[model samples]
Target chain A: MSVTPALDARREFESLLEPVATVAYRVAYNFTRNAEDAMDLVQDSTVAAFRSFDTFQKGSNFRAWFLRILTNRFYKSRKRGRVETTPIDEAEDVFLYRQAARAGLLGNDDDPARLVLDRFDVEAVEAALDRLPDEFRDAAVMYFLNDFSYDQIADVLGVPVGTVRSRLHRGRKILQRALWDVAKQRGLVHGDGPEGAGA
Target chain B: MGTARRAPVPKDMSCAEVFARVQEYLDRELNPDEVEAVKAHLDYCPPCARGFVFEESVFETVRLKLAASACPEDLMARLRECLEACDES
Candidate 1:
């Protein structure tokens, strides 16, 4: 069944906005790591998406298309000095590693004690996330936490699907290695036990 | 004393290869053969297993933290107001 041109376009646009808005906000939050910045980015992206509604092709993945707009807008405004940049590097890594390690060491991970300490280590993970490079952290959080698929991520970032896969693959590896190192140092995992220095 | 030559995990079995299947593993998207391979590798290789565990934990932690940091009532209200303003313009 063919849809009436104007009516179909409007309906399509509205439908797209509902689901995409939440995803956009989540992605923005991951990118900015601040409520105010995320809110602004979402708002700006929404308006821009509405303005360019005609350019969006029907039956295409709207979520990715809209996200690409949001990401571009974010970087443009960021370049214009609207958003603050958090430089992530060795210094940030060292700080986060130390913090998580100390936190892990102090938290009781023993069987019975773990029941009480599970909540505390979430903060440690957050600190580790804060240490990641902005793009890696942003993409990782969006894909893993927000549940956007690889194709959607590619569309959002205006890159090829392979690039998204590589970014996520690399981003996850770095995060996993960092967290494991911290966990090992903190004694969260018994490396020297039957697991034997790796587990 | 000669250095012990560790058995190779197949150069094809780099951390990247193991990690690529991780999401699939978590989502139960892998078929039997792939699942078996990943599981077998994890069983013998503590480092890879630890890495997987770490990845899982990070995902869990981020999910929890994001849930906890949901936009407060006032913040949501403010965001709605801003959205409405954008609509009017």
Candidate 2:
């Protein structure tokens, strides 16, 4: 019966992971657009999580812990492959808000967010998210899509909470631009050229 | 005539300041004082308020939709297998 504790530990991990597995995979897939790579990431991170189970606090946020492992592994692998040192995009935040305002899209009493939301479906949102650079895209997906709190995102990304805040701020601005362009291409909004040139 | 309470300075948290921190506000990352300041600005600023609504909706609508999506069935099976292997090992 020496294996009983280990077995129980495994079972507990599995049970905890069950509910978050899909989300974990989704997060991984968003990190790596390929399915196989995503699966490998999930498995690798899950196995890592299993090994580090003892360090995990039982009552605390297991999902965040596991996702931290997943994201750490991902960043580590990228480091091993090649070092990418791009500066964070520090462009004006709320690109869409400005664009909408210029296009008179925000002039109406209509819900601007709803107006934006109605223009694009999930796939379009995903596409727009995918277009973001690695740093911003990861934060955007984790926060907006994966529902990670700023704390969890900071832990997962191995950055400070302030960095997470900036990344999300910039990421969202970039996403707004992406969404605006996509909507225009689809004719979802009329009048004014891209980036509000006409308006 | 009844005296009215003083109106907000309108300069307290200008539209620019509110816009700069709107994401934090929407994410509920602000402290009480900060939240109140942002709220005061939002109250008087219709355009900023509408922008806040729009920004909030973008995160919410997308989050809800993407959250409902599950991984592929085969991927789930593989992940389960992964757990089983780890358990046995």
Candidate 3:
């Protein structure tokens, strides 16, 4: 198909790039699980998106379109094999929910600490996220963490909407378990028996 | 173990179900009946309530962390280089 002139397309793409960069980085980080990989993914996706700018329908979700390209690139590069999946057992699931509740209760809106990240073990949570399988992790990061709607996530992943929901559900379950395990070990949470012990 | 535990909630509402609907509740997407069900469940179940709390916290944490970890100076230079190369071709 005939496309916009290269210079004009580049200008338009440049204008859209900055606003979407943070979201793109978040999506790439979730998929690749490393800063280096995420950077490469964003760069490659940007180039590819710029080249195909003609097909990108105007007035549509640009972030989702760009993410779809990035996620597709990620899977293509993974032709070697799929990552190992970590399953969350039923007991761990229950404990995770309980701990999440307690954490919520401790921090209130009036508390200044609530607004800051000082007390929370963000590093621990990030560590747990790093261990998730690529698909679920990417889905969770894009949908929940990035604040994309389910339809947006589906568009970005180029998957059916139902698959997006399924990945998010499974991903959240895994994260809940992982976060509990990490927090319990670090003593960030109390009264939750050792990870997997209560279950 | 307490009066809250003894209260009756809808049989359809399990922790998983409540967890799934947490996002809906936050977004105000739940209908009156479903909202009531989730509210009643949250009222009785500490774990489910905690789970929602953690979810919100993690969500905020992820957002802040991502924002803080912007494209580094070197990465921005590299990106500029890549764009320049693309323009040349």
Q: Pick by TM-score: which candidate is best?
A: 2
TM-score of model number 1 = 0.56
Higher DockQ: candidate 1 or 2?
2
Task: Using DockQ, rank the candidates from best to worst.
Answer: 2, 3, 1
Best model number under DockQ: 2
What's the residue-level lDDT of B21 in candidate 1?
A: 73
**TM-score, one value per model:** 0.56, 0.80, 0.70
**Candidate 2: tens digits of C-alpha lDDT, residues A40-110:** 89899888988889999989998878877888898888622122433323435566767777677765656
Count of clashes, each model:
1, 1, 3
Q: TM-scores of the first chain across all predictions?
A: 0.57, 0.78, 0.72
Candidate 3 at residue A31, lDDT? 66
True contacts kept of each: 0.07, 0.51, 0.10
Docking class of predicted structure 2? acceptable
On lDDT, the leading prediction is 2
lDDT of 3 by residue, A1-199 (tens): 6655776767677777767776677667666766778888889988888878889998897877777777678777752223454554423343443553445544445332234233445466566676567777777777654567877777766777667756765666676566666666677665543344233
Q: Compared with the true structure, what per-residue lDDT tens digits does model 1 show for residues B1-89?
A: 01223233343465556655775576564567777777877887865665465445546555665545455344444445554565556
The total of clashing pairs for model 3 equals 3
lDDT agreement with native, every candidate: 0.58, 0.74, 0.64
